[model samples]
Target: MAAFARRKEQRLSRPDPSRKRALDARAAELVRLLNARERFCTASSCDGRVIVTDTDGTGIQKKNCTWLLVTHDPCVKDDVMTALEKATGDVVFKFEPFVLHVLCRELQDAQLLAVRSTHCLEVPLSHKGTLMVSEEYIEFLVHVANQKMEENIRRIDRFHKGLELALEAAVPADTLFPKGPEKSHSVYMHRRKRRTAQEQADPSRELEPQDDAESSLALFAEIML
Candidate 1:
């Protein structure tokens, strides 16, 4: 129990090795940039990848998912495509969004960083995304998970703009810190704007309410009838 507590303390103190563990040049550059920020510590990230897998019924039990090539950058180059051609199975490129988890010193600090980091959904884009406040740490995740290459690039560009805005924003005097881990995994899901009862009603076909006096008179007339 004592050892576990000590490990937890060490984890909360700083980012783990995964933050700096980049598989390729692009991932390495992103890790470097995130680690350079004094107010931020990366939790996890991946550059992007193109995987080749064996789908044919030639392997053991006719099931195989062999990786011919796994790269950390965009697999758009001619040579990269050539490698795919040489693959023994189906060539698949699974475009992963650039994701970064950072610990912020305070709510204001997170707000500043969030505004700078481009996010996938509007929830993270807002200040509400900051979770698990502490005396010395707060957590903010930068995510842009798009499977489409063009959309992924666009979303990442937007996130980059958000980061720039945060850097240029004025800093707050007060700082907030994390106390305990806040479980908010649901924040990663894309939030849909729900239509209110009023919004759901067809405006063009809706019947206006009769005046109270008119309604009462109508009831009386019905009784007379």
Candidate 2:
């Protein structure tokens, strides 16, 4: 328990290492809220983005690609056109939805958040350059991507609210820290059994008031995607 607390503190204290070198504005509030809670801390997050990349035919590999343009908010055609002008190889346009990784204080805390997980969408607009699609088609693709961005924002909002409710109902951190190995094992088993019962009772049940925010920190970390 002490180790977990120490790790969380260290991670939260470290400077951001992402390309932007800071929390995305759209997800910053949610990330801050999670870190403020005793039971959870955000490891990493993206608030969703529209990107145009120049790749060496190996697809979306970061090391093999150059990011021509990236925007956290909806992008305009002029911006995309300007980016495409710099592409020397195969170009791809993409819309990646919001993603967040969180660390939980306990197994039960992970499971509780896991139950609220939602599906994420990644939309690819172009496989090659402007050769395969018309100007009108590109405009249409941008419209669709923008729509997806809107939905992504809605999911983030839902997730924020659902987490607020969950944190309020969560057991206090002091109570969760065990005094000994035996007590820790007992608590783990009890939580496991209760989680099993809950799942059996209603397999499809999700966080109340909204069902769109469906992704778990545990699952995201395990997948490492």
Candidate 3:
């Protein structure tokens, strides 16, 4: 519909709001690829990260926590140790894998890429600046985090390839990308209206409820651990 296209354009034109104020290098290509298609646009994305944060006892409230170090690439033990020096409360080291939130033009478009799993590692490394684990254990944890980072990259690659294949099969190559903004908008609205009518006429077809921007259809591929 014209409304959805307009919203996508408005969102894309706005400034990036993530802490880094930019797309992660690892996710940049995939984001661009998806944006090129009329049926999908990325909402938010994180390629992966290794982080050290000083948190309260619960470690769940970010408002009371301080991020000491954050890196997208695999980090070494020295990096964690260096970040630990800045800790004033309980310190937690975390390895978070790639995550992407995509807004699809249709429910079926989202289903094409839907994947769900939950896996992330967080270890409480220090209690009030005092080491709670042995130096060797810290080294081992860093090694494991590094390995997870590597696996995260591979998963991203796999997801990219799979998406490419899915898009190719779902959309015609010539129409997958529009030539210009004006033409793209017109063509997209026309196709959307036609699809809407078709779905409405088909009594067996199930319709998804219209959602607000915050509840837009999303596709996610979480790390498997």
Clashes of each: 11, 4, 0
Best-matching candidate per TM-score: 3
Give the CA lDDT, 0 to 100, for residue 7 in model 3: 81
**Window of ten residues with lowest summed lDDT in model 3:** 211-220
Cand. 1 TM to true fold: 0.38
The TM-score measured for candidate 3 stands at 0.74
Root-mean-square deviation (CA) per prediction: 21.0, 6.0, 9.4
Writing each residue's lDDT as its tens digit, candidate 1 over 1-225 gives 355345435654664465244334444454555556555555556544434333443434236654444544434344334444455544333334455566654454454444223322211111112222231211111112223334545544545544544343332322221233332221111111111233356545442342222122123222211
Q: Tell me each candidate's TM-score.
A: 0.38, 0.73, 0.74
Question: What is the TM-score (0 to 1) of candidate 2?
Answer: 0.73
Judge candidate 1 against the unseen true structure and give its global Cα lDDT, from 0 to 1. Answer: 0.38
Q: After superposition, how far is residue 141 of candidate 3 from its true place, in Å?
A: 0.6
lDDT of each: 0.38, 0.69, 0.75
